[model samples]
Target: MIQKGSTLPEADFSQLKNGEMTNPKTNDLFGGKRVLLFAVPGAFTPTCSHAHLPGYVALADKIKAKGIDSIVCLAVNDAFVMDAWGKAHNADAIEMIGDGSAEFTKAIGLDMDTSVFGGIRSLRYAMIVNDCRVEMLNIEDPGRFEVSDAETMLKAL
Candidate 1:
């Protein structure tokens, strides 16, 4: 897992916009800004759909009011799936990032093998990143929702 004060790993992530796929470099998205990034194992899963993602969406304005430049939600799925999920959930305030190959998850040492679900997936985690460096990190235990939830992160901020 990434720790506070550590520089975030550089990688490329895919996002869908207007039916087009855009690949953005991590540095381009997070550099020179305060970003709130959260990751889930998969898109549309129980906890993620019901709690994790919705929590952030509900608090998007408050989080932005705290000087956050962006709120990003990452999942180990393709851009199309993420796009559909975001639309279904009305997640207009958050950027839905697709780590299709789990490259970013592996780079950050948050990879987990859930072969039952598919293959390698990301652990549930959230971080406050400033200018490409991690300022705060919260990683939830397996099958648990605790520290990484939006309310906890908001309190941390």
Candidate 2:
């Protein structure tokens, strides 16, 4: 897992724009910015849909008010699925990042093999990144939602 003060690993993440998929480099997305990044195991999953993502959405404004430049929700899914899930949840305040190939997740040492869920997926985690360097990291235990939840992150900030 990535640790505080470590630079964010380089990777490509995709976003859906006008029905087209566009890949954005990690530096371009996080450089010189205060970013709140959270990862889910999969898109549209029960816990993610019901709690994790929603908590961030609910507290997005308050979080940004604390000087966060962006809030990103990452999942090991394609751009289309991520975009759809964001829309379904009214996640207009958050940027839904798609790690379709799990490159970023693996690079950060947060990849987990949950083929039963849907192949290899990212572990549930959250981080505060400043200018591409990690300032705080919270990784949840398997099937748990404790340290990585929005409320905990907010308190950390």
Each prediction's whole-model lDDT (CA): 0.93, 0.93
Q: Residue by residue across 1-157, what tens digits does model 1's lDDT show?
A: 6789999888999999888999998997899999999999999999999999999999999999998999999999999999999998999999999999999899999999998867999999999999999999999999999999989988888
lDDT score, residue 19, model 1?
89
Count of backbone collisions within predicted model 2: 0
Error of 2 at 86 (Å): 0.3
After the best TM-score superposition of candidate 1, give how far the Cα of residue 11 lies from its true spot, in angstroms.
0.7
* TM-score of each model, paired residue for residue: 0.97, 0.97
- Model 2 residue 143 lDDT score: 91
**Cα lDDT, model 1, residue 101:** 92
Q: What is the per-residue lDDT of model 2 for residues 19-99, given as tens digits with 9 covering 90 to 100?
A: 888999899789999999999999899999999999999999999999999999999998999999999999999999999
**Candidate 1, pairs of clashing residues:** none
lDDT of 2: 0.93
Can you tell me which runs of candidate 2 are displaced by over 4 Å? none
